[model samples]
Target chain A: MSALIEVKNLTLKFRTDEGLVTAVDDVSFTIDKGQVMGLVGESGSGKSVTAKALMHLNAKNAVYSPESKITLHTENGPVDVLSLKTARELKVVRGGAISMIFQEPMASFAPAITIGDQMVEQLQLHGDLSKAKAKAISVEMLDRVGISDPARRFDQYAFELSGGMRQRAMIAMALSTKPKLLIADEPTTALDVTIQAQVIDLMKDLVTEFHMGIIFITHDLGVIAQTADKVAVKYLGRIVEEGPVREVIRNPKHPYTQGLLAALPKLDDLDAPLTPVAGDIPSPLERPSGCVFHTRCPKIIGDVCKSKLPHDTQVDGSHRVACHLHTEVPA
Target chain B: MSETLIKARDLSVGFKIGSGFFGKSILKAVDHVDIDIEKGSFFGLVGESGSGKTTLGRALLKAVPITGGTAHYADGEVDYDLTTLAGPELKDYRKRAQLIFQDPYAALSPRMTVRDIIAEPLEVMGLTKTREETDARVREIAAKCRLNLEHLRRFPHAFSGGQRQRISIARALVSGPKFVVADESVAALDVSIQADVLNLLKELQRDLKITFLFISHDLSVVAHTCDHLAVMYLGRLVESAPTREVFKAPRHPYTKALFSAIPSLDPDDRGSAQKLEGEIPSPTNQPPGCKFHTRCPFVVDRCKVEEPVLEHPGDGHEVACHRWRELADTLAA
Candidate 1:
């Protein structure tokens, strides 16, 4: 499969009033065509920051490392995302080749504008389409996403629709641009379970039909298990473990990943105790010295975990984990 | 059986919506709900948004006005009728029951220190007399909730989501309430922190012997934490049973669909569970019969015309569905 996008040594920090807080530290990953890469992490795990770095969507206070690089392969050629400074130059990476859906559908949409108008505006901005054609395409996309009476819903405001319907509308709008890569940041977190299931099914279908690469970012391990082919578990600002979904979930290598899996309330075995990762995630300002997860690691291997960062050890053909438990110790 | 702490029969909470007089309509947020909470039981109430789970919780707490039916609070010492409860009786009930809000960030005041937030409830109820007494009470509850005594002087803004939630829990339990209504208390926290909070709640419930009414939308969470579970849809109680019983064999279609929709952790188990179609109907313009008829996969003709009452087939499992028995047999076949 052809590579859709590649991120290398991408370290991001925010210039805050107190100090420079590192958000994403040397995070690197690649998305292949039609593959779903699930970025799993807790609130401060930097999953969202890594997703935003792909589209250059972070705030003005954000700073990127000098060695950071993002290359998006398009029909034309390989486009360097960070090098594209101007809005005109960045358009190809924005809604043109990459589209994003947010957790809160209401916040993403304009209160005053109709759903149809917003969708058509997006399509027209990205491609050369007439107003009539864009409107037709938007309605078609809405119908495709399983919104009943799509034509009627096109004219309705975002508030007029239910939470489920609004989410479906947002998905339709995002896909209307026909982008190669879709970045869904907690898209189903706001919806009910039934609605979330429907949205997940729709996204899976869209992936196959359009053959588009998707970066699904969420704190929900269940959602990640269902939707993603590959999973990257993040802690603090580092990718602690990266592997095939089945391998990572069934047999997690990193202590942090194991803690997360153990923490989830399992259905098959309700008697299994919910073991939460020990201690609160330290503030980003006072990041741990060696491994980011060592402070809370259950199986601490002597003083090595506290002093030096562990290198990524290949577990299998496709699986990789960065933890002292997996890495070889020099005699 | 253990002592019934709170008992409700056809308890309903209604609110007037729309405009003045003629244009106004009553929105029944909690309708004809029957519940019995035994002392020291962690009872769970689960439903989607707009399903009146929160309304039912608040109604039981007397936070919302109970418009119809009867609710009794009997904790051996005080047996007061909740519907007609007022004056000193109501004031006393405030000390007996408390609510832990859902959003920890928004629930705690940004300006108030952790100590003051937890101490406010004690002072309001006049549980402690001297300043030292209030401080002593606050410190004890804070320690029970697993909060740092040093951090009690710091404002809420300095703490994380998990710590703030603990502060809220401490505040709710400071008055030494026998009953606590934790309304989606851990929904806002991350998964790792969510487990931590849930464990803390379970520990507190066991230690203090507090009858907890845990309200949440997440089924797996309720499954693990609660002893008894009640499933709600559009202000109606569809099913109520022990946690294990409900998970092992869910009778109501809505309950089954809710369990199915959780997105299994096993990747190989995808799409095996039945998915409910369509969104929940608007409460204002609800269907005439069963509220779940619109989305239920096993919905029959009888479901659209007449609402089914709760029926006990055996054990403590209560289900409200016309074809639950037949559906159960057929699924087994």
Candidate 2:
């Protein structure tokens, strides 16, 4: 199947007081229909920034490179995302083909409005449906997401619902639009583990039924491994590694990826000592000269790693990593 | 076994809710909890929200008012009944037991430098005779937390989440407490940075030989760090066991469901996991009888009427369940 969304050389920067700070640097990836791509990164790693750029939802100070391009394969045709300027033009991409949910359900929802009113409004805005039909669709969507007594919950405000319920409501609202690409940014980070498992299962089921491409952004490797088909590891705005989820989890190629996996507290082994990445992630202000990870990388070679940028190396048919230790650079 | 640092029997903490028309109903956040912590061991408390894990942790440290039962704290020479500690005894206990907050961003004062923030506890508690002595203690703890001397002069906002957490740890350790309650300490951190903070905590625990009450909802984290584990459900102790035993073979249905709920790293190994349905019951309006019966997959009719007491099942493991043996046998068959 052809890819659903393709992001190529998408360089994004914010105009901070300290000058242009690159949030996403030369990142490229693709997600096909019925596929789930996991964007994994730590804070300041720019995973959220990259996701935001897809819907043109970044802050006003965000400056995109001229060469950057994002193509969305909608039912109509392939449409360019970055060039859409007007809100009328942006509507087709914002909620039509793409829908996004956040880590904090409260932040995503309007606190004063009832969940039913908001969901119906979103449906009417995105599709040509009557108010009654939209309301019926909203309740059905809520019930589909496992929210019990959907009609009763429909009239409750965001505060009236519990954390898990609010998240489910948010998912219901997002999926009610039937967007071809769903971006879930740390959707389960604020939830309890059991609730998180339910949400993950619900999302997986939705993907199978709806056949929509999903971009799951989270820092938890376990969640990514369980939900994602393809995984992309980001560090300080750069894609350090990208591969099939099984291959990436089974045998990581990048040193940073290895450190992250090693650092996780594994359920199978209680005796293993968690070794953290050698040093702290460098401040965005002090962006490294050549290799972004050289300062913290454990297997750093001689001065070449310090002075030169590492090219991407193909480890297998699909696994790719960017590090000097993984590939030789021509003199 | 090592010397017992703290011991409690039938401890309960209750808060008055809706004073007017509700007639001041007592909401029992912690109901009849019994816990024992060995000296210098990591005792973990795991539970979902409204599970009373935080309240239970605070009760042991005397941060919350204990409504009933008795608690004793003894670290070799200094010994005091925590529930009845008062005046000079309470003041002394404050120095012996301390708490580390969950959010590092809000834990530290924005105006204070890192050195002053870490040194405030020493100065307030009269642990140091002079500023020089306070600085020395702050420097020692800061070095242990892997913070450089230059980082001491910066404000709390100047540092990252992991660095700020280290500063908070240094502050908590400046008073040289014997017992520490870390409530969801690393929950706000990234996974990689979480490992860093966890390692620092383990190292500090070893070097200083301080007993820790680690309260968190993450079972994987507790399994790796804690020597013993206690599972709480709606203010009750449902299960308690050694870390290895609990992970290897959990007896409580709630505990088993909780384990199965964790998303496995293997993509294809999504076993017929016993998924717990519904949210944790609110503490104010808790379920009658067994609190977990509302969500327990293997719940029976008997569980709907009578609450189960903690029963020992050998190997230092205690499970509160009416049908663990029967359930285990059925599963085996």
Candidate 3:
């Protein structure tokens, strides 16, 4: 279980018009080689921000804490991602070791350039490969990702392809460089169910072949259950629970995790009513004083849940929960 | 069992594509679709993008021009042919039917307050007499949607995605529409909030007795929320059945493939999905025979030449597949 990337004490805030809004607070997680870590969260949960922080891809308004650290291990050595200031120094972390695919492939791809051109450009930038070699590598990657007629598809622009193909092309482009870590932030969210399944299968096959660590971020518990080896449930910019995917999904320790699972419309039980988390997720500007999830936590014990933030309590060997109900022992 | 609130026979919506004389062609977005929405039933229409599920829903609502076929809107009290509906009847139909848009962020106007947003529909439809009457209706509907009266004064920018979606729902329901078309209404929402909105919609259906034409690509959500289901592919209704029957014994290949494609919550259930190959064909240039023959696994020579009409094998489960009879036998085994 050799770690590929390690993030610790990651506290991020954005300089907004209202005030400094905390996006990711004291969030720490790790991904190992050939493992998939699912970061599950809703809109304001800061899952995307945490993934962006891994590659130092946060917006200009983002301000990281002094104690924040992201360590990425490569063949060369362990590099501190935060310390890499210059673009030249950061290239090692950017596309060489870390590649990301977004929710919308169309937004990520350039309208004018063909999908092949983008892949070739990425390959040449990261590796000392000739133009012809780059083209061949791009075509092979496209074919590997299940794109039909790779040579003809190589000449087609992003707009020329359908939604599924565009997504496959994006996946093809990301894996062409053979990065050690792939951060796919809601990669299948924009796609249809059938296409989503296909993409998920492709990703699983890629993981087994490439043996690369993947950070799969999505709010979908089903997707997490199918794809992820480990799961981390985030709420209001903090990890409320973490455990093995099966354990976390089957027996979620945190109230937020339990609420999320209960909220899902299960196909197995069509008669069961969907039970949503009690209250709405509070605004970031007016964040709660203690636990961020206290407002919505159905298992809130007492004033302690509303007054003091609970520390992470280990439930089992690998399962851990951050809720006052689990952490505090009332006499 | 109940009275049919909306009925359509071979309804088609065609849009003229291309500009030049020779290049001009009619893109039949909704092609020869037959559907029935029983009163007080949640009917789910499921399909991938470009499948024309949205267009079919819109055509039913009279939001789009129906180029062919006939549709009827009979809520027991009022009976009107949706196709030839004009002038006062069309205006009256607008009050009876409404659409809930998918994206809450783009649906609501940022300039308008929540109160005005909900009230706009009522005022435009001339449902209320005065501002006092409009405010009363808005407050009533907003409260039903779990929106606070204080929150009504705030602009759309101040609310979250879930809150904005509630506002959208309140606006849609404020007009007191008997038939509502919710097109991917909860697709943009998170799973947690999505459940809340879905529950709200279900509650609204039971309390208000509104027939919802719920259009979405999510099979799991549709399975739980809807009483009846229709699967569309390439602008054609491939299968229509009771929700339980559709889940229990799906006759159509596309429908069965759709069910398998939904990612299971159990980790052990890996990629055993019946993966469908090839993309949905473009509506502009559909295949010669069955539109789905290109991707159909059991496709044969006959499927490529002659289109299969919707056939009821038994129990009112209509399936549009040339080989469904054989497929059902195999599925049974």
On DockQ, the candidate that comes out on top is 3
Q: What lDDT is obtained when candidate 2 is compared to the true structure?
A: 0.91
DockQ for every prediction shown:
0.84, 0.76, 0.85
- Look at candidate 2 and tell me the lDDT of residue A74: 88
Q: Which stretches of candidate 1 lie over 4 Å from their true place?
A: A329-331, B20-22, B330-333
Writing each residue's lDDT as its tens digit, candidate 3 over A188-303 gives 99999989998999899999999999999999999999999999999989998999999999898888888899999988889999998877888999989788888887777778
TM-score of chain A of each: 0.98, 0.98, 0.98
Q: Please give, for residues B1-333, the per-residue lDDT of candidate 1 as tens digits.
A: 789999999999999888876789889888899999999999999999999999999999898999999999999999989999999999999999999999998999998999999999888888899999999989899999998789899999888889889999999999999999999998888889999999999999999989999999999999999999999999999999999888888888888889889999998888787888888888888898888888877878989999998887777999999998888854332
Off by over 4 Å in 3: A329-331
- Model 1, residue pairs in steric clash: none
Each candidate's clash count: 0, 0, 0
The residue-level lDDT of candidate 2 at B172 comes to: 90
Q: Which ten residues in a row have the lowest lDDT in candidate 1 chain A?
A: A322-331
TM-score of chain B of 2: 0.97
